[model samples]
Target: MTFPLLLIPGLNCTERAFVPLLGSLWPLASVTLVNHRRGDSMAAIAGAILAEAPPRFALLGFSMGGYIAFEMLRQAPERVERLCCLATMARPDTAEQAENRRRMIALAEQGRFDQVIGANFPNTVHPDNVDSLELRDLHASMARETGAETYVAQQRAILARPDSRPDLAGIRVPTSVVVGEADMVTGVDGAREIAGGVPGAELTVIAGAGHMVPLEQPDAVGEALAKWLRR
Candidate 1:
């Protein structure tokens, strides 16, 4: 019995985030993209996903979605058949990062969302992709779909999430940690830290990619996911 697979997107993202990878593995498994825009906290978001998810499922999460995935593991470890976190960190936000989030929230409230998107783009993609018109346009379109209010809510939720490092040792399910070599936002070191905490977890690094590794290297990501599911 193959488990259902759920994909969770990062900040200001939607199902479109997985579009690049969908064609690569659609027939192998049932894939569902959870809406991360509904809730304002990790707990709320996790709870909502859990409530809608099948009794047991494999989960792949990116960035802010990774934070929510960790909360889901904490909430119900048994229901998860496998877990994968990409371009994410297990540590909670530092004071400075939290303050930055607050500032972004304020800016969003003032309807200056394009400012937030502009400021975030550098961290969201590889430095090379910063000038890539296609990547930039895709990101901008996704951000627009998410809206300013959703962005503010997600930022707050991420800022408030607990440190997930301690919870990792308890993870018995098969796990994978993937990161982009050029990911400045959540660097390879962060993915390494997560893999280290979870015994026997696999780690994959995609060269020439950034925080949005799945979008940039979907075929690589799809192959990694498919192999993990088979194991």
Candidate 2:
């Protein structure tokens, strides 16, 4: 029997954040999308997820979801059959990153939430994809569905999340790390770092893609994930 698989989307993301890739990967298993609207801290968020998660499953995380994946491994190692992280890093929020989250939160609270996300649109897509109308519309729709308060809560959880460096070396399950070659927000360097630290992990870099690799290059991301799940 094919066991379940759980997909965790990035910050300010909704189920739609993964629609393109989801269609391609649906045949491999019973896939579930994680919803984390109730938790204010990483532990609380992770706990809430695990509370409703299957007893055993494969875990795939993207960006902020990767951090939550790390937390899940720490919280329930035996339950995860395989793990994959895409366009993600294991580093804890640096002072600069934390401050940026704070500023974003302040802006959201001040009713400049649209502006906050608008400013990030540049960094969110591949430079070439920045002008793509379909991608822009999809991102806008997802942002509206996620809304301001959830974004702020996600930022808070991310800011408090643990550094997963120490946890990486301890990973005993099959692991794969995928990143975009041109990702500036998290960078390929962090993906390399994650691959190096996790035992027997494989790394894949999607060319011409940026921070939103899965959305920017869905077919490639889906193929890579397919390979990861096969092993």
Candidate 3:
């Protein structure tokens, strides 16, 4: 049977962020691209999406999207048949992280959007992929498509999101925590923390990848998702 799959995009990302994985994974299920740019708080955002989501479906959340996924589980655990947290974390943003987000928000508001991404994008990929023109442009495109207002809203939601560390052990679905071995954004240890927190959660570290593992290693991400889908 084909299951419904809801794919959530990260901060400054739109539907394009999952383009690489679509062809490989779409055939296995009916897929939907969530509009994560709507709300300024995690609760509001999660509630909005949950209202539109299928009764029982698989959820794949990346980066800030993972924060929403956690909120979704908290609100309605049975609705999420399976979970995949990619290049994300369970901890609430630290003061330092929130300040950084505020700085980025300021830059975008000041009409220095590209500059904000220029300053931040390089560190989001593997050291080797940092110089990749395609990768850089893809991210820039996604950010531009997401625009400044949504970016600010996403930052606020991420900033106010609850710490999921205490809620991890309650995840009762088949879960997968994936990260890039070289991911500086979330890191392998964070992936391990999520995996260790939930019962029977599998951890997949894509080699030669960074925070953008879904794009940086589409084949591997596809393979991992395929395996998760089987469960």
Error of 3 at 225 (Å): 0.6
Please estimate how well model 1 matches the true structure, expressed as its whole-model Cα lDDT.
0.86
Candidates sorted on lDDT, descending: 3, 2, 1
- TM-score for every candidate vs. truth? 0.96, 0.97, 0.97
What residue pairs are clashing in model 3?
A: none
Q: How does candidate 3 fare on TM-score?
A: 0.97
The residue ranges of model 1 lying beyond 4 angstroms of the native Cα positions read none
Score each candidate by Cα lDDT. Answer: 0.86, 0.88, 0.90
lDDT of 1 at 225: 76
Residue 50 of candidate 2: its Cα lDDT? 98
Candidate 3 per-residue lDDT over residues 42-129, each given as its tens digit: 9999999999999999999999889999999999998999999999999876777789989998998898988988888887999999
Residue 191 local lDDT, model 3: 86
What is the Cα-based TM-score of model 2?
0.97
For candidate 2, write residues 45-92 as lDDT tens digits: 888999999999999888888988899899999999999988899987
lDDT of 3: 0.90
